[model samples]
Target: MQMGIVRRSVGALLAVIVLLGAVPVGAAEKSAPRHSAQAIGKAERAMQEITAQAARETATAEMQDTRISSVMLHWTPYPAAVRYAVRVLRGSVGAPMKTIATMEYVYTTGLHLPLMAYGAVDDLYWTVQPLGYDGTPLAAASEPCPVREAEADPAAPALTTEYAAMPYAPLYPVYSWVPLAGQKEHEVEVYRREVGHDRYVHTLRGGEYDVYDDTPFTVPGTYVYRVRGVTAAGMPISNWSAYGSFTVAERTPIAALGDSITHGGGAITVPPSYQLYDWESYCTVPVKNLGRSGDTTEAMLERFERDVLPFAPRVLIIMGGVNDYRVGIYGAETVRNLAALREKCRAHGITPIFLTATPIRPALMTARMTINTPPSDWWAHRDYVNNWVMQQEHSIDVATVLSDADGELEEGYTTDGLHPDLTGKKYIGQTVDSYLRTHFAYASAEAERRVRMLKNMEKTS
Candidate 1:
């Protein structure tokens, strides 16, 4: 029985060997494929190459996204351009480009856009077409401007305030600067020019890019100012900017006091630093801009003692109430504020000239400023305030030219629908200019009479 079992095991082993092509274990190991050291190294290097290429591609994509987000297109303000048409094109230079994004109504010379808004494109360019009030092309489309990558870090803040010598210097000067990115606040230092040196008078800190110095410049003297950016931790983030100098004197001829409209700057992204956006820029007369960016009628009235008192302007053009009305403040409240402002002007011997508030288009306002939600009764409030203004002895109905048939701000005259752009501002400024020119001799005579009265009183004393 044992012999028979042994024969069966041997037969089974022979059958397995036959199934394995009858190869021996040692022979099978030798016949198997073997890789050379050189070959193995080459395979590993290829994998490293593939990984590096992937990392480079990811870095390029991230850089492109950063560039797209920071894209801001700026152009020279075209003459007679009520508005501009901006088109973003995608293609290589000298290649047939396709317009990917077109903004039909850009009110200012600058336009900020997220290039990613139109999807991924290897090459992008922009062009501007100046448009007339009637939507006619005022000039041919500008040559395509390449969308270059923006700088990683913008330069330090630079002062933008206009300086003048004593006797012509503004008493209530608006201190303004080009704000730095990531700035938590701005530090403004005022120094009075004293005995062959500048004496540090005061230092003020605020979050706003522009400051209406409420501290009255009562003394007529030379003053120097500088600004720097600060971090939230109270640490200085930038070096002191180049000094700005102005001389302070008494009695400004004419000044404008209002909200952002009179403060200058329109078109959502542009700041008041750009002169073209300022209505005062279009005026023939040199009107000092006392208009703060976000002042309501109440705020304007409150600041009168501090801001308007120092200037002692011969004529103060008052345009406000839109900030109050948009937020649903009662028209009566705004009117009361305006009345208070008028009374204060009279008390200080300053002539107060009212400007009818411009109408607003809620749809456009929402599109431009999502945070803004003008009340449903906003127009009613505006009408109430404007009606009161019309009854004032010294008033100009600027709203008449800015409002459409439906009483909304005319699209051609505005970019944000709330603040009037270049065209509307031009109309407002020119109207005021014409009015002032017409009554120039009368105003001059009144000013002279006041001067004579003051001199006589001084002589008697």
Candidate 2:
């Protein structure tokens, strides 16, 4: 019976070979049948089914591995720590542990490691070291703690903008939040708090991580905003983030406008959201911060009409040009942009206060941020811009206080060589405060006069 079965299999194979040999090679090629659209569609659907099955299998495996591999590390917050350093280790049963990864700057107290990061390791541990503002170790490294897995859940967006203190909100407040994974879109809703209920004021949708609300809030009332993530199909993916509330007065008395320096924040990892890093926070005079991070002179000028007009500030402190000169933009062009900003302020009856651009320390900048290589003649351009600033009617020489004898940013005053740290910010804020204290009447008179004239125009219209 086995011999008979083998003979039959051989005979079938020979028949197939003979049948294939009978067809002329070129004829088979020429007569090949074209697939119908339906057939192609079926093939594509089948491929998609296979791909989706593979993805599902991969997701299931990942979920299982995540049960044992994902880790959320938390430690008591150290008093002097501006940031923390986290080190991950791997080890075997008998061998000693070896360092696998080191995160030099962690802004928050808790760090989450996903499955993909350490799924392959059977034994993993981590340690946290507190670091001061100057990157000095504030405390000894914590004992290595064994990584334990916890169930992972999708997180809602975390709001970054805050208006908790008095003199509540900026005119053109930037609403920003940390984005969530797999978030395709975001929905934002603004509500004005009324006597008995919250009234809906605005609703907007965008794909970006932040929305700069161009509409000026002129009313003296409290407003709240909440944001949530949405899927591409318009389905909600996350619950609404906690409402960020702010109160708006009739108008801001003084406002600062420029690039990152004016926006606040230093020590590299810390963001402008922290009041400690904001120069405005150190100033005795109440000044609203209208500054946005990463704004070039051109960008600042472009946003002046939309961002500044809303606040209707009496005095606008302008400190920019660092972002320009460092990127090799011609000094004359920056001056032109600044001049345009000045003209716009004057046209709108606002006092334009110019602040001299600070110098950069290329060596420290390179060490901390390799991508920020300033041009060889960056200082010359800075000098040119500062010279232009000094010629303006109202100017503050912040650069003079922050610069060393060699014209570079004083090493002690800065962390990244570009942005002035707390000490430098304090000096700048104090200088501005002193100047304002002496000239408050003049700035206020001019601003008030403009407000009256605009109101008169409105009545006539």
Candidate closest to the true structure, highest TM-score: 2
Candidate 1 C-alpha error for residue 251, in Å? 0.8
Q: Give one digit per residue, the lDDT tens place, for model 1 in 356-447.
A: 98899899888767656889999999999999999998999999889899999998887777888878888988888777767664664554
What's the CA error at residue 238 for candidate 2, in Å? 5.7
Native-to-model Cα distance after best TM-score fit, residue 158 in candidate 2, in Å? 6.2
TM-score, candidate 2, is: 0.60
Residue 439's lDDT within candidate 1 is 63
Q: What overall lDDT goes with each candidate model?
A: 0.72, 0.74
Every model's TM-score: 0.59, 0.60
- Tell me model 1's lDDT, rounded to 2 decimals: 0.72
Reference-based lDDT, residue 57, model 1: 59
> Which candidate wins on lDDT?
2
Q: Candidate 2: worst 10 consecutive residues by lDDT?
A: 148-157
